[model samples]
Target chain A: MNKRTVLWTAIVLALLALLVLGCVFFGLFEKSVVAKDVDQPLSPEQMKTLAVRGAYVAVAADCYACHTAKGGAPWAGGLPFTTPFGTIYATNISPDKEHGIGNWTRAEFHRAVRDGVGKGDTHLYPAMPYASYRLMTAEDVDAVYAYLMSRPPMKVANKPNDLNFPFNIRRVLTFWNLVNLPADMPPLDAARLEIWNRGRYVVDALGHCGECHTPRNIMQGMKASEYLKGAVLEGVVAPDITKDGLARMGFDPVLLPAFMKSGISAQGAMTNQMFEVVHFSTQYMTGEDLAALSAYLFDLDKLPDKPASPTQPKPVAVAPELATAARGNYLALCSGCHGIEGQGIPHVVVPLSTNASLRLASARNLIHTVLNGIPGQHFPGLERMQPMPGFKDQLDDRQVADLANWLRAEWGGETPSAKAEDVAAIRRDE
Target chain B: MTIALKKLSLTVNGKAVDPVDVPDTMMMQDFLYEYLNLTGARMGCGQGICHACTVIVENDDGTLAEMRTCITGAHWFEGRKVRTIEGHAKRDASGAITQLSPVQQAFIEHFSFQCGYCTPGFVTGATVLLDELKRQPVARADLERAISEALDKHICRCTGYVRYYEAVRDVILNTPGLIKA
Candidate 1:
């Protein structure tokens, strides 16, 4: 209670208060990124072409898949994305003046997409995939803007996002982005072919194939060590598309372009979300672009190929009921294209007998392929395969189980069979 | 810059509702689920390949035809008599099921559906096939082909074609007038 001690305590408290206030003031006063508008009036033809090119860029980005909700207006948002933090609804990018990006300037839109900075210095959560979009070329961004601006505006409002505690703090995203965004992306090798370089840019940068296919660390950042080896997405495995993985799956490098275009290969078909990606994004890509993508993918480091097929099963006679059902089902459902002896019409229908899907250790892929018929994507310069219709409704659980088992027994060398309960479980999980 | 909204009116599942304003681009699938609250027609593929959003439309020729609602627009269905999966089962005023239609009953008996995403489409398609067959009965020899042709376009993801076919066959054979002995 002495005067000297009391005076000293008061002075210390004042200094501490000033220090805290100074930090807050400095942080709050930090300047935001300035919008750099490149807007210019374009001739009608230029506008049209720019918009058209932008449409392609948007497709390559697969923006519609996340931006649009199931049965909701395209680009009007409302797609709920679930994260460890919470659900974040996509923002409406429609041209509506009030609710969408209609009022946004080119600079504002660009910054929002590339830098994850929204209007008025607001930080957009990473769920927007700005990390991938950040790699988009300026021309691509301009084209996308042109395309979006040309669309008929929808007046739908953006849904508010729901996130948990500290994660909800939008400012916290800056730190997360700083820590996670890949910092060492190498410059494209000038020695590579132009087409190959283009493919690399699209696949590794804009397309962000690793975002889904590569495993994530505990911090939710993509595991760079794993690369695109394979990862679980929404419980279903997004299989390795690496050269080694492809070779093991019996994927011929020559047929990769075709596979990318239509989502079908000698092995089997892409189902579920991969189907959506092919339908919405890759299928629409130009032939040259697809070739480039395939080239880039094929160039990846691969594991040494084994002399013998690991999944190939020893020839064995299947149960009579299963064999009979498979034969009958084949006649009714698959014979038109796959043929009587499971010899698929060359260059048309993919063969079932030697298909890799039937020989996987886990019957999940087989079940998925059988349940969800392989629909072909249209590609220029390729004979479009007729889409395989799903027999999920027409074939009961027992029939599917039998047919699947028969397929493995008949064609897949030394493959295990699937049970009815397995079929039921796959169906239920879906 | 808004897309024009049109007034759409259709007789759905035996009820004729007053015209309601709907977007010109609104798919018939959205019309049934969003506006009419008929969620039976689940959307599988947004495209027409899956046939999971199929509904029965009574043709002017007095034949029942299945339509893919996901690809078709709500405006396309204006003035049409559309029967959804909800219409197949007889319901009291409160919408409690009073009776299951022949196809519904057969489905339950044969365990024809798994996940049941495509059941509505199948039921509607089968109902139409049955109605058409009743108009002109198929001989026993041709029964299998007739069923195949009728239901072949439909896609079932659960790969339940065998049971669905068996159930539909059961209905055709057991029904008094569907098949010629």
Candidate 2:
């Protein structure tokens, strides 16, 4: 062969050899890391402890929210979560030897739970919230794994995710994780109190409150600038929790913990999605934790000034027939709980006449509450009370309107009365 | 007409009990509430999205775990052992009755429940989480995640998710090294 040909051939072979060596080196390195991380045998006590921590982790991570199809076994998967792109069904993570992650190794489980990588190098969708989970510490991940491993074996198989075209490729998740997920712990602000820091850590990491409350970009990433100012999820609006007085309920930060725990805001009662969250999560939290959260929330400085009050529209006078019926119903049903004079059992039951929530400037709230019973709130230093029964079934539309009108005029002091049409509108909305 | 009944043996709240004849299609939730009088595990949603019906199913090796009883058939629990929230509040060494487990205490201190409908489920789930963690050294993130996971099966319509997270976090943060384990 010619010298030139031989040189070219030699260079080509050298390049090929280098590529092979690089691949092998990477493969070995990956295996070493996996071995270092995987299957670290845990003691039974340790395992049990992990299981407990795992339960808490699971709660914060909201695993069952996306997994566990409606009416299906918890963690058995098959819940169809709809996104802007398409519907995605979460996989079964239960300990079932088949149809679930039961056969997965500790490393495999960790990868799926924290890294969003599934078995056989499959990439799970971001809907799994692994991007946020990626910030979880190794010990936290291990505890979750232990807890999951200890679960009773469920045999339910996971349904395949329905994604369109290129999005369906699982390998793409590695790229997504690389771009969107954080591998290390979140940076702590030294200036903040330990409790506040702790609250921030939980909110940002395992709690992932921002995932729902913060607005998102076109790529579905959270808009860092708009963090926790509130956003919409599943057609439900998560009200801005920022101390934006104009944008939020007009209460000070001191009232936030109580509001969060009780679903009673200074401006109004918790409605829609916020109510659900209060019922599910916040009411159970400690006063100290709530206080810490409130402290952090109060410290937010970007709020706008409160808006000027608008002029009240003309009130619709209550019909005589409706007024008589309302008074009679109040005497029969409500007087037992709330005294005939509108003085509720002190501390035990909220007094209607003086209660700020009941006396809000709109009869809309009173109507809502009377029609749909208010769920109890858990304020610190207060005993938990049974929820008030809704009078929707017993009261006619006109009766509800009359009762709300009377209550607003008599107890609310300044609020306008509700009309029959207003009650009809609320009934229709429900 | 001939009547058919199935006989099974299972451990309930740490005690072994001989199974009586029950319909094959009887729901585990019904069996617990009607037959065993284990009302601690509730039936918030009969379909099982809510973990109100959760119970700790003990394996043969003495290790216990949580399961939802609403959708599970009684036949599936034939040879298993189960513990409910009621079982967690047992007598201590001195034989005096104690009402609060660590999980329960954490819940109460935190004021975790609003309507109290989902509290039992959360308590049961939290107990399992605490048991698994061993030492209570949970970081803030870990604590939040732990509470979230424990509450995944239950739905509360009162307090926003904040209080539940706080209750569990309080227990972990207060208890040294529990979250780390």
Best by DockQ: 1
CA lDDT, candidate 1, residue A417: 61
How many clashes (backbone N, Cα, C below 3 Å) per candidate? 23, 54
Q: Which stretches of candidate 2 lie over 4 Å from their true place?
A: A1-39, A245-247, A262-276, A300-430, B1-181
DockQ of 1: 0.02
**Which regions of candidate 1 are displaced past 4 Å?**
A1-49, A82-86, A162-168, A300-340, A344-350, A354-356, A359-362, A369-430, B1-181
Provide TM-scores for the models: 0.56, 0.46
TM-score of 2: 0.46
- Model 2's DockQ score: 0.01
Cα lDDT of model 1 by residue, A1-430, tens digit = 9999999999999999888656543344333232344544445676688998889989988888888899999899998988889999999998889999888877777778777777766788887777666766767877888899899888899888899998877876665566566532357787777776777777876677878877788878777788878776764667776767666566654576677777776665556687778877887888777777767777732212333333544666876766665665655455545755676765556777667766554566766667776666443346455566666865778888877777776776535467788888777864
The DockQ-derived docking category for candidate 2 is incorrect
